[model samples]
Target: MTYWAAIARKSFQGGSTVEVPLPSSPKLIGASLLPPKHDPFYSQLFELEIQRHTTIAKRFDFHGSMIDQLMALVSSKSNVKNPTRVEVVTALLNRCIVNAAKKNNDPLRPFILFMPFTIQNLLNPLLPHKLVENYLTFFLVPIPDEGDLEIPTLVSNIQKEKINYFRKYKGININQTISTISNDTEDFKQNNLANTRLTTSLCGYQFYDMDFGFGKPEKVSIGAMLIKYSMVLFDSPCKGGIDVVITLEEEVMPNFEIDEELNTFTSLDPSY
Candidate 1:
């Protein structure tokens, strides 16, 4: 990667430009139609519910500092300074999960979560290229069967469980793992693939300084048709703000949009 960056620098010094082909290391994997064999009833049940549900898309702009503030509060309350972004995000997700559970008529059911994990070299100072790889990973977060617990405890528990799972299975072949998890067999008996409900992605990436010969773009965004019950987090064009693009069931979307806690940080019609 550094060698390529040096080559690019040399090319620019010679007053010439080069356009290389896109990297092919990461390939796209389409959605799988495999069933959860152990819990075929639940699989069929969610599928039927999905068909009857209507999808809706909405973009929300919220104060960026809200997360920082939440982090500060968490730190002060727990006497643990320097909380990571993931902690704050987990808190936010917990809020959403609780809200969704309240709106959901079913309590004993679990939800499917599909989040894209990006492996990028940008953060590695030794690597000087913008190449990145992405994998759609699945996680099952358990909601209460009856009422709820405290938000901080819920978030901390989920994060700890996830960290432990990754520590136990880190560096294994992701493709093989995904294949085994997706297959309808006994291999996934101990896994959590059978009960996933909500999907979320953190897309608020910043490449504002990326340039060739021209200046930076005024804005950047991902324009894709998302599936229902999914949420995407994006960096707003302006500073001190974040954008949440959510796809939910049509009936539930309006209720979600009017959520009091969510509305606290949201801007009024801050459309892009």
Candidate 2:
């Protein structure tokens, strides 16, 4: 039987303690979900369409309003109104890593992203207590030496890698993978878990909008962690907007805050 069919059967039969659905199966390969195994990825807040950049180079600028303009470019270029947030970020981060490499003069400088997935409804009964947070460790593979590539190509490359990752690690024991990384430092290095960036998701999650028969929450947050180089993606309280929280080092914070490209689309005032 196919791996997904087996998972479904186990989920219904109560044969397994963790009923990871087919969708969540790929992420179940371990490494990204455990915080202790990897460094903390940062988060950032981008204001919506606060400004625009005229130059083409500024579109992918990490420090400028380019990030705000990025979605529009991707949407228009790909003809997709609501492209996947994780995919977009993955593409942007890939470019950022490459740009940072040139600035830092490191040819092999690679960036990794730790992304989370929601598996709340994977179980048969869909009990709240059974919910599990699964994640994937994505390596920002090096781009070719060719000239500037488009966003669609960027998105497609990462998507293809995801499929390849699943096929390669199919049927691996998730718990064993985690334990191996925790116990064997060499294994962790081989898995590239030590050098990955972190990202979290709250898409389609509306705790901020939950009325509970009372007024909506004035503020909602996951609370701040001292983690650096991590990012969290959330469905913004504002309609048709997304809120990002990026944490960076004190020295790097200044560069990102004053980034002309980023601030173009981001509001002047940031929450954090």
Candidate 3:
């Protein structure tokens, strides 16, 4: 057998894989025949239509020293200990977004932040090496509606939620959760998934190391922000720094841009 084929076989035999059932219908059904439902996933599509017209994108650069200072501050707090760079940054951005929403007089609703965690390492025993495909699991973090919480508290809350999720899903429980969520349409429909924010970090992906025959890129960016209420984090060209891209309603962008707390750590990237 080919070397690649042998490796694939071994991975499947490792017993970490979960079988996903096929969809109930192979053919597309007419919308007219379908019952109208208020699934958040489908509702977001309609919201996106309005968002595309009224949302704007902004990019901010956080210097390495500033990041260090923020991390130090977070560490000093008694509530949360040894907060990672990602957690600190996520907390800060989430707080800023919530504040901006309040400034815009947006309606009060529970906020859910969806963060993706890599599961490739978790399956290391099953696969000898990283596969050239997306292997991820998502955990949702609930953000407080009141944005007045201190940075340390925010970080602590996030850390606690993550810990609880991990403890509840130790080992193959995560695979089962993913399988059920993916296969059960009724469960998804019943859950309220609105007011959700998406976050992704491209750090440690080594984008700066790639060469396209013209030498390595000086900077990397996620060109356009198509999703509202989403944040993308990238490793800055300089080491130990991060570039954040945020999308919000145009009305809220002005207040968010000039947020006192946010401005203390980040500077607007004029090049963006």
Candidate 2 ranges beyond 4 A from true positions: 1-69, 75-82, 93-108, 119-153, 163-194
User: Clash pairs of candidate 1?
Assistant: 111-196, 111-197, 112-196, 112-197
Better of 1 and 3 by TM-score: 3
In model 1, state the lDDT of residue 258: 67
Q: What value does the lDDT take at residue 154 in candidate 2?
A: 70
Q: Write the per-residue lDDT of candidate 1 for residues 64-94, one digit (tens) a residue.
A: 6876676677677664456554445545654
Which sequence of candidate numbers ranks them by TM-score, best first? 3, 1, 2
TM-scores of all candidate predictions against the true structure: 0.61, 0.52, 0.74
User: In terms of TM-score, which candidate is strongest?
Assistant: 3
Clashes of each: 4, 24, 0
Best by lDDT: 3
lDDT for each candidate structure: 0.51, 0.46, 0.68
Candidate 3 C-alpha lDDT tens digits along 113-190: 777766544431343242343555566776655752567877887788678655544554334545533444443345
